[model samples]
Target: MLPVTVEHAAQTPSIFLESAYFNFVLKAVYHATKTVLAFLQRDSVLYWPFLISTLAIAWLAWRVGSAAPDPGTKSSWRAFSRSHLSRELWWHPSARLDYRFYVINGVVFPLLAAPFLFGEQVVANILNSLSTTAPGLAAAGTSTGVVITLVFTVVFFVAYDLGRFLAHSLLHDVGILWEFHKVHHSAEVLTPMTTFRAHPVDLLVMAWGGALVTGLATWLFHRFVHSGITFYTFLGLHVMIWVFSLIGNLRHSQVWLSYGKTLNYWLISPAHHQLHHSAEPRHHGCNRGFELAIWDRMYGTLCVPTDVPGRLQFGLGDDTDGRWRSVGRLYLWPFRLLAKRVQGALQARRA
Candidate 1:
């Protein structure tokens, strides 16, 4: 104790360092395994894992409010109006309305746009250019491209979300674009699926607009800068897609998660998005970036007021309950607005 040897202390630190290194390796291996498991869960036989994870998340949410019967406060074992926070979209009364739009916007519009977006002539032109430059790429064959295309399809979905944010900001700020896109924000209820609950025409325009801009940008990036997409492009995109989906859902939830401005770059964080959906004019163009805050920052449309709470209401100025809120009405509302504008213009000319 009086004279501790350097060798004795060195032995402990060496052992401790070795132990820490082992723990780091173990954690790394565990995370790698988890990622692989997640990728595998997309297969047919892996449905059980997917189902289990979904149930687990649902159970986790339930557990937060699953208290035993209380003594004094009035409550019923057979509850009718459960807390809004506890209920999923399917259980919500207006959920069907939301899904109705989603089917039309996410599924229908995408399919409709595919012909125009990936037309044979367009495809041939694109492939011919790539084939001319990278002749070896053709040898990979249709199967390789098909497999690659399957992966790109997921990227396109992610890209659409990013596009929607920009398109949304434009809808509010730009004059004519708003005429077409206003139909999306016209919704009374904001839900996770609300992102997909867009007017078919608006959906088509925004999807194509963003796709065109993004595809061209990506082509330039791959063609000029990198000569091809980097692994990080795919990895970063995949990570951001999952993150945006998770955060986007919260933006729709009644309960708020305010990240202020710190994590806004990493996430389109729910709190800022809520500000965008606000009925307040000040928050009209807030949180414009879909996946990256950089877009909002670059365009100077980002809004995050420190003094006021992010919680705000949503509903287009012309909204009428059970009227223009239906899926059919959503599609027709723009046309009606257009017709009204035309009539007013004619009257003004006569006057």
Candidate 2:
């Protein structure tokens, strides 16, 4: 009996190691790692390769074109790079927490939500309904001409930018939603990876909004014109790839790249985004557009960048409670406060 029991115990570890649950965990970890790496590609703001190249080019151009002395005594470029492109921000404890949230939001949650969202089916149904009511809308899927495709491409770009602008503005204006969005503004230092330092809730909201806009635009184009063509691509990326390669990463960096007041009316500059992260109350709801400043200008939310760069501080003001800086607290405290608010409402209703 003793020998039999000993044999069974010895086999237990092997059994557990080979179990389905263990394999599932391993698979999840592998996929999460892959997703994180993919997002860190040069095209992405989270990575430094493209950003560093862009900075170097800009620095050389500035040195040759401008008469201003180098930005500092020793090496202004070195100081600028260290402050904004530091590995400290990349491997920071807070950034690790953000990466975990990115995995859950970008991969896990989407998989879980697929059944409920039925995004493909929803878009298909909407297209079908529109086609039935408006026959011209169905014409978009018929043609494969270059001219038609170019028009659709422009339409999609405009629609996407508009949708993002609306969603960003709402996140700032809505008090309850701002609680989740504030997680992003809590950053003390700005790095390219700081772009990913968003709460899962905020990510979900932005994604849904973008999806809806893109879906609607596609349907409209298929109904009226034709599907878009990608003619100008860099490494199979859209034409907009150059935008990211050139200036997107700078938006979240310490570097100030102003488009001037006139150009800023049409386009968003790096300095404009930095102002968005400014701790000042006046800047709180300004410059909400993602790619273009057209929406902000139309909606009266545009705050043009100045020639003189302001001394700006980031993060929520007066976070003396410390919850804003702590990852665990940031994730949990908001939900708890929400729950209490719900409970209070229920009690008041009953009374």
Candidate 3:
């Protein structure tokens, strides 16, 4: 949480000095490039198939006149691209910053957060060892074992999803955490890369929350009532996650795809997420759940797309202007703001 001090800022010029520091930065960038490219893998929502699926859905929306006032699905690719991928949208400064974040955070954040991650099996074993009795479901492959796996897989998915919702809600509701989380809300534009436009602290909170909940749920299941949902995998994630990810990338894009009123109440549509990013006051802090609308519905943060059909602005409040556009500021300002919060709290305590 060190501040980007005057002395530290002054050293920026040394980056071009051709010294060991420059070489190190070059190596980091090289690895980071590869990391950014890895987003195309099956495990990622940015995988080619998933992105293509998103485009297909968006195209369908255009054809049905669901995306805009006029249907353009019948238009040429050039026309569609001009409308959806215009320079004013995709090439906007805010989205450019997201691209930078994806590259930098890809290599840096994982290395920083690796030590804090938990291995699910290891966590399950530890939990089992602490108990006096043997715990675990019937071994894999038998009829009973198959039943245990099938039932608990759904349980594991729900538990993991709940964890995601809880973690996201906290990042929005908690003041101290919200400063770091602002890096995400600062995006004035959304793209698939916006999925990776997260601060490391934000990412850490999500990763830890997922691991802890899933790990504990797995342990409890392994004993019919002890298991990890890791047994089932589709495209490198649990079946639920994989299914949700089919349109997950669209959540961070300009497409206004909704599952309509009925399903929207039960599941999160990309439009549910778009409303979450709305700059309108009422939309702020709404629609925090990733896959389920139940949490938002229970907590009363749900905002169905039909509620506001007019044009919606994105980003933090208008005062932000372009201050968050700098990649360096996006990374450093969270620490500065957080430190200021701590300092102010301490001063108030003394008074």
Candidate 4:
């Protein structure tokens, strides 16, 4: 592996800028549209299965049940689409900031993780030591077939979800972290793109932490149990592809698709996530799980929604001072806050 030297790190920013500007920015509008479509159709939170299912259920409910279309709207479909895809929200300057940051993540996060990628060797060494001390662990490194591979896939998904749940909780509980996390919550409207509105700092931290957990789990599974059992991936992603294609995109959508009282205890619905984004003080820090509600249930953070969805106002409320509304401030202001925090800490120490 190549060493991550000062010269390499220095060159990364320029490399990223050149690649991002020429390769990314030049085609950003196209990519951004593609990205939004993908979110709506396949990946991230919104998947086609979930979308079709929600639409089908909503249509049925409108035709047969008390759930009716909004009074001013032409139909239920139009009302639902208008609520989630209003031009003001989709074309908001803030949404553009999200696309820009998405491009930045594509370029920057890999460079940031490059140095730490070498730590895999250290983890391998530790696994070797453990295997040497525990002969049973040596069996873990042995090659295995389809059954064990399936088991490993289950373990991988659980570990990934656990990491996401922890990182999300910390983002809410920690002040400095919340400063960065607030960017996602600052969106006044809910769109699939709002899912990408994450601040880079928040994204990087969660990405690194989640990657570490996943890498370590993978190493342990391969080292101790079955080396041949790898991720059960579809389109190069783990089970999340199914999750996204099923009901994941709905998590960030205005659609109110709940798994109901009993099922919600097992699976998190789109309504569960929309409730999490609710600006109500009661909803703050309520549902933190990414793909599962079991974590929230385990941690006493779960709040099941009613059969009827409630109206929600999204955003961070008055604490933002409107600074979060600007793309420039969204990128720069977090660093400024961090600097002030460091200076204050230094002064307190001296006193």
Candidate 5:
């Protein structure tokens, strides 16, 4: 239901990096230099930016949480409101149920996934190459290797996020995909807990797409640029996304403030993303940018209504099949819909 705009209206920034297939060797040099520099400096440069950004982001979270109106009471005359430390979140039966899954989907899955990605073979290949490459890269400088990895990681994240933003936008715009996406928007109230209340199938699809995009970016960056990989450096790719999620926990709270309404296009603000969660037709799929708003702006999916009342509701319309109201139902509903569709198609052809 996102507002349809003219094509080419969103002239997203053109990707300026050198060709992916041919730039592998130069990227290796960048990686080697960055790794050496990071080791020598103990990642001060890396951690400082993260620390400062975290603090600034934390302040932003507090501000936004304070702004959310109380949805429990009609007196507030606003929508999607909750306290930063809403007792209801910690004790709400629905919240608790959602938390169990969040832990598995967010923290546990990430930890379990590391081993698979950083398995023996993957590590061995990178380590073997690094032994020889690091020595030469070290000669360049103390933090040269670190610098290389840092730059590569940033670029990788940009590409990965770009892909995610575009794909998610498509999911909302495409009728077939919207059926599943609607499950996510079906939340009646906004809370930190609501952030993780996505259908498991939706989570799986998102996780897989993210992993695929990151992996492809990493492998291409390492093989062609730095000649190898450094796991932490590679991890730095999604560092912003992780931070965004950590901060995003605050976005749905009653507090609300937006810094980069225009600039944060690179890093989506809570206010910016909130609009997307709105069930209203115009708001739907509007703020499709995940970690960054740039893709939305560039692709014309950006929706910033400076004048409209805040999103009044956060779920699907009356047509929701109450059967999928529970956590288990949300997960299984997609498959059931698909099955019904397939059956209908087969019967129609036979008839």
Candidate 6:
């Protein structure tokens, strides 16, 4: 107590760190485990209900898929297993990258990327500050009326769908953004886990886009109508989104469940998404919408699927697909490509 010592001062930080490090590690592990466990819950695509729905749809697709016989329906179980479920396809080097991407994006990406994510509520609050509305109109904090709730539900759902589709199209059309999104399109084979195989940057962009549009819609509703309305939900999810989740898993699978020609014009089926994944020249940038076809149809990007299987091939269809077969490269290559583009631009400018 009488004399200040350097050893004592240095030891204080070490002692405090040693005391806290164990609990910090334990807390991190606990949260990560909890997040991974959510994969099995109803909110997730890997949930039993969704997976079972995919199976039922697949079986039905084989027995009776379209109004008429579909070429995809003629595909045998052996062909489906070989393409989608085989030891070769599932265990391929490219699919191994997807597995690693799934783990990283699921367990690690959310933690590191949370601070970068924009919340729709936050966006709405910002927009609300810029606009003036009658403050005394209805109770601002409380919700009322099932009809209003249902309408809000549909509106919010459409907002989300529009945002998602627009973001997806931009990722295809924009050169700079495509560098990051290319990680997803590089998958050679599709699986349930492939749905999770996205670069964290890709997820961040999509999240921000969704938040901005949905938040804009939220502000409009609050300004014109009342802030006392909320969307209807099913099991803690938007009713429309929960319904979409039933067949969502099949979108990245080998299963072909088309909504037929007529509905295909209005809706996007699993077949539509498979075409989106296809590396063919004509199929590139086609069917980018998640559920609705109107966005794609209006944009001239819609390609109504004909339910023919085995015609489409996946991946970038070039050397990059093989070169980025490792998960580490999948993460780093986008940055490297961006750097190269910057370097090239500078050199050209100097020349």
lDDT of each: 0.53, 0.66, 0.79, 0.69, 0.55, 0.79
Work out how many backbone clashes candidate 1 has: 0
Candidate 6: tens digits of C-alpha lDDT, residues 31-61: 5676567656767777777788877776666
Give residue 142's lDDT in candidate 1 (0 to 100): 26
- Residues 1-351 of candidate 1: C-alpha lDDT, one tens digit per residue: 546677676568777798788976675565445433543443211234433443343334334432212223214323312433245534443456776665445444544455655422243346448756562322322232444554454555445556666666667676556656666566555665565556666665665657655565444433433333322233334443443443345455443444555765555655566666676666665677665666677778776534335335665544443355577777776778777877888899999
- Tens digits of lDDT, candidate 4, 1-351: 999997897689887688777765556555555555654544444455666764565555444432433544535566655655567767766666666666655445444544644333355456667666565455555566778878877887877778778888889888788878887888776666677777677876676556666667877777767764666787556765464445455576566667766888887777788888888888888889877789999999998987655567887765763457666676677778778878988999999
Q: In order, how many clashes per candidate?
A: 0, 5, 11, 5, 34, 0
Question: lDDT per residue, candidate 2, 273-314, as tens digits?
Answer: 988988777887789988889899888989998754545776
Best by TM-score: 6
Angstrom error of the Cα, residue 223, model 2: value is 0.5
Q: How far is candidate 1 from the true structure (C-alpha RMSD, Å)?
A: 21.9
* RMSD in Å for all candidates: 21.9, 6.0, 8.2, 6.9, 18.3, 3.8
| Per-prediction TM-score to the true structure, in the order listed | 0.59, 0.77, 0.84, 0.74, 0.60, 0.87
Once fitted onto the true fold, the runs of candidate 5 whose alpha carbons sit more than 4 angstroms away are 1-97, 100-146, 173-178, 229-246, 264-266, 305-308, 321-323, 344-351
Q: Is candidate 4 or candidate 6 better by lDDT?
A: 6
The candidate, 3 or 5, that scores higher on TM-score is 3
Error of 6 at 252 (Å): 0.4
lDDT of 5: 0.55
lDDT of 5 by residue, 206-315 (tens): 65556556656665555556745443432343454545544555455434556543565555666666777666777766777766777777878877634225445655
Q: Kindly report which residue stretches of model 3 are placed more than 4 angstroms away from their true locations once superposed.
A: 1-34, 71-79, 133-145, 224-230
Q: lDDT score, residue 223, model 3?
A: 58
